[model samples]
Target chain A: MSTSRERVLARVRAALTDVPADEPVVRPVERPYADSHGMGAALEVLEDRLRDYKALVRRVPADRLAEEVAAALERRGASTVAVPDGIDADWFSRTEAVRRPDSRDRPLELRELDSVDGVVTACAVAIAETGTIVLDGGPDQGRRAITLVPDYHLCVVRADQVVDGVPQGVRRLDPARPLTWISGPSATSDIELNRVEGVHGPRTLEVLLVE
Target chain B: MSATFLGIPPFPEAARAAVNDSRLRHNLRKATHTIRDKRGAVVTELEDDWERLRSEGAAIKSHTLRHLDHYLEQLEASVERAGGHVHWAADAEEANEIVTRLVRATGETDVVKVKSMATQEIELNNALAEAGITAYETDLAELIVQLGDDLPSHILVPAIHLGRAQIRETFLAQMAEWGVPAPEGLTDDPRALAEAARVHLRERFLRTRTAISGANFAVADSGTLVVLESEGNGRMCLTLPETLISVVGIEKIVPTWADLEVFLQTLPRSSTGERMNPYTSTWTGVTPGDGPQEFHLVLLDNGRTDVLADTVGRQALRCIRCSACLNTCPVYERTGGHAYGSVYPGPIGAILTPQLRGMSSEVDEALPYASSLCGACYEVCPVAIDIPEVLVHLREEVAAGSGHLGEKAVMKGAEAVLGSSHALEAAQRAAGAARNLVPRHLPGMAGAWTDTRDLPDVPAESFRQWWNKHEKGQS
Candidate 1:
């Protein structure tokens, strides 16, 4: 029997017989769009966009990062926080919550992730124009479920990691790894096209922007 | 729970009923207008580059479609290399069978689903149910539609036709039957509703071992499938499941990874009118310890080749399903999605459904005429699909096909009369002389056209006669 793959490809080839034999398979596409908006205040812009999505954003200096994270988690009353593999231990040193570290060898169970009060992780890249933070399952970010299953997400973004636009953000990432690009907490406009936040994903997205 | 678009009335009949519906009209108007304004505001923010980005998006899709076979092979090879199995499905049945078998192979009867147009188009959920395998729709809108036993009206918001009150009622009435019961005091507040859905679906996401999804864009170079969504259900389904199956339309391919820059920038703005939707998940294949352990990609053709066959019609394949066209369409805003009677509705549906399904059915034939050809859809389309051009092209195809014998005969006679000056003048004179004898309504099937419209009164004399008299000074 002929494989469906062969049959589908055959149909496709048969359908496109009009193309010239010499036509290049890949042609240069014109991109007149700018690579970057060149908004020099990418951090401020990122903050504004993040706040616009109702995500709580706080900027702190490098030395105050751990203190701010601890305060934010305390404010949220998060008693149990899931920490990814490579997240700095110092960042949670001042926190009162018990740390549950997730690693490849000893990953947290789905129930444990669900039961955790919050999750803390680092991002791969942040897009200023869209206010999106991308996680590529890096050691610091751990598995995608760590930030997802939990109701609260405390993502740390560095000032240096922010890109001015989506194009710049896309160019900086590797597609081979699984990536979760989150702009805000999960939202929906399904009911009468009204924007409603905090659905399925974490309800609270608190970003600690370390300069 | 088995709601389908099958056996729906044709566009004219369906649209007439829809237009008369006051509540549906109010909901559609409010929703479409809100999104339209939001889209305008966000799109204007990129005023300097929006058009260029849209053109670039169109060019990239065109380039990919022209060499689709090459890219499909590349995508398949890349996916396999990334430890994901690739299955080719010629049509809906093949795709559904493959998904069902894959689920059964895992000995799992239940699978969580991200909102996917491809799966909806193939009715995968229905197929799974037939095999005694239940598929849970995890998207809030999809969940509402599934629980309410309703067909999806809009592409982005499947239950766009239903208001918040209706949703709360649905949850209160049906949530328990599905899984978790809705809270007793659940109000119609959008936040409370969203919270209810989150709480209800959380258990399923954590428990369901298998998931099915669809891709917004499939990067051929990297074998990456990207799904941009506002809610996190997509992330849960893509991440938590042990075995992931994505049934993707073949046309969802982008030639390169860098090409995502064009679509990612345009899609969110064009879709939910956000700078970026809340969540976008991208996965190439199975990651060892991070996401799904096993991944299967089913490439679906299902009339896409037929769509590709027509050079003019092939542009419909460029659609990203952003649905900006639907929100901006005047005809769509009034009649809403159900009138088009396809999973895809609005201007895209008018051209797309007919091409995908062929113009054999009354619904398909009427779809090409569903538009006023106002060009609003083309203006807002992120990929720049010239919807009006396709509508006219499809109209011509539908007209040339079988049926409409009476209309065809009338057109043929009128063609001869209008083709010659002598015949036209004589016919005009005859019409003028017999003006009083002409009935207001035509006989038989021809009356259908004049039923809701008035026939133009015959002029006392044709324009040609007046022109001749003035030129000859014989007025």
Candidate 2:
């Protein structure tokens, strides 16, 4: 009869009871480097690194962003796209593709969305050095299954949302939230030490470096 | 079909048999070295704060273990609240009985499995087999191990002792007897082998109604269980089944989601040398219609409470089963997992198996002496467990009364000679006088050591005699 929140809190308390309350929770330290001239240079470095990991990156002006995204989807020949509730309407309204909201659908509908070519959503935060995008199951990110089921994911992130390192990202995240940190596409290696890509999760990831 | 690691021979006997096989040694050397080098390179890339992260991981585990009783109760209550059942088992028999009953209640004769070492340590597959239920291993390595009818030799790479050609032979000969058959004339190529395995497992993935798993970490706060792996097989097994059962050891609990950050970094890098694992499946209770409709968690003790009772030995429970220590161990490299005579093998096995199952058998007693106390395992252990220190402690325990009769006698005789200055001096004088009579090759019981190595020549004069003739005059 106890609520999920109560259960989680009780466990946390018990696990931490033996340690001193004042003990510092250590966070990873970021290595020092020369500061970028501005957010643009940092964004460029992020884009470069993301490209190095084989993530597709594109830059668009604020006014023409929706049209560019729609065209990108069309180029991939996608008919339907899963859209989070908080995503800007103009992004899909301007496109010819059908938009499916993750909140209103059941498992069957989600499976249907998997057959579609892609899913587009805004990210909570991005790490530049590791080329990781974190989706916290917030309104924009929708359900965890939405991004996970789709073959291709197009995540939108503003330049300011980018952090220099994992430690900085950890500081910004709430521990209670459902967080998914993605570096690149899902991959695995066999016993013979041969690497294979795209077994589960997203096979192809396209990140729109919207400034 | 017994769950015990009983009737297993001593380490030297088992290893002597394995080392003579040139093919097994070649496969083991190649696989272990490749993984070792890749792990070292990736770990060195984060050279700035690697040690700090390792220390943080160890501290978090230590903090959680110190209050495990409290966290475990909280977790049980939470699971109950979520309409999921929780069962506590003290040993392997109790655990197997609980699971067998649960599965029997579900009226299912088959169950899918995630790659879980705790379950393997208890030999759950064999237990289930005796009960007339079939448990399929979904992890590729585990599948290979099960189908080949062989024991796992390495923690991560269970089939490390076999090469690609051997795997092809195993699949071609045995895959049909299990559930699926390999394609006609399957070659020794790695891709062909993987495609064949994929085809073989896909049917079982879609059909199995019940699933069993072991966790990487269990968050007591939310009663959330996490399993991280490189393949999608775990995700499929976790989500598709109607009823899911997880048998996790108590030591796997972490305080909160925040504590997961340290392990997420350390485990992937240390185990597979990857920056991140491909599939990280996290589920809490039933997610309505998203995953398995019914969930049961069997929290296993299985001599863990005994391990936890020992202040120094308790750190062995902090292991995540990453197998980093195994890859880096020199002893494990030459002799392999089969020599350890237990499911848990290598350096971790040397310390853990003896403690979990007491040093009551010849194999268990010899396990402590399996290592050279080289400290390589300690260096690579993510939790910073001083494995060599534990090995030495177990050796002392074995020397007193816990070891085999022959070993205990040998230690006692050695102690009598070395324990006193007069006895040691007198023994040294006797040995020096008998130098001419000493044979180059040892005879009888001592021959095993000389078989692989040359015997050291005893000098005509003892160091004591030489010192007395020269430097003693000055005194």
Among residues 3 or more apart in sequence or in different chains, the pairs in candidate 1 whose N, CA or C atoms overlap within 3 Å are none
For model 1, what fraction of the real interface contacts is kept?
0.91
- What is the C-alpha lDDT profile of model 2 across B191-299, one tens digit per residue? 6777677778766866788999998998887777788876567766776678989999878988766566678778978888765565566667765545677899988
Q: Going through the candidates in order, what fraction of the true interface contacts does each contain?
A: 0.91, 0.12
What's the CA error at residue A147 for candidate 1, in Å?
A: 0.2
List, residue by residue over A21-103, the lDDT tens digit for candidate 1.
78998777566798877656999999999999999999999999989988998899999999897988999878788999998
lDDT leader: 1
TM-score of 2: 0.81
Model 1: runs farther than 4 Å from truth? B406-475
lDDT score of residue A19 within candidate 1:
84
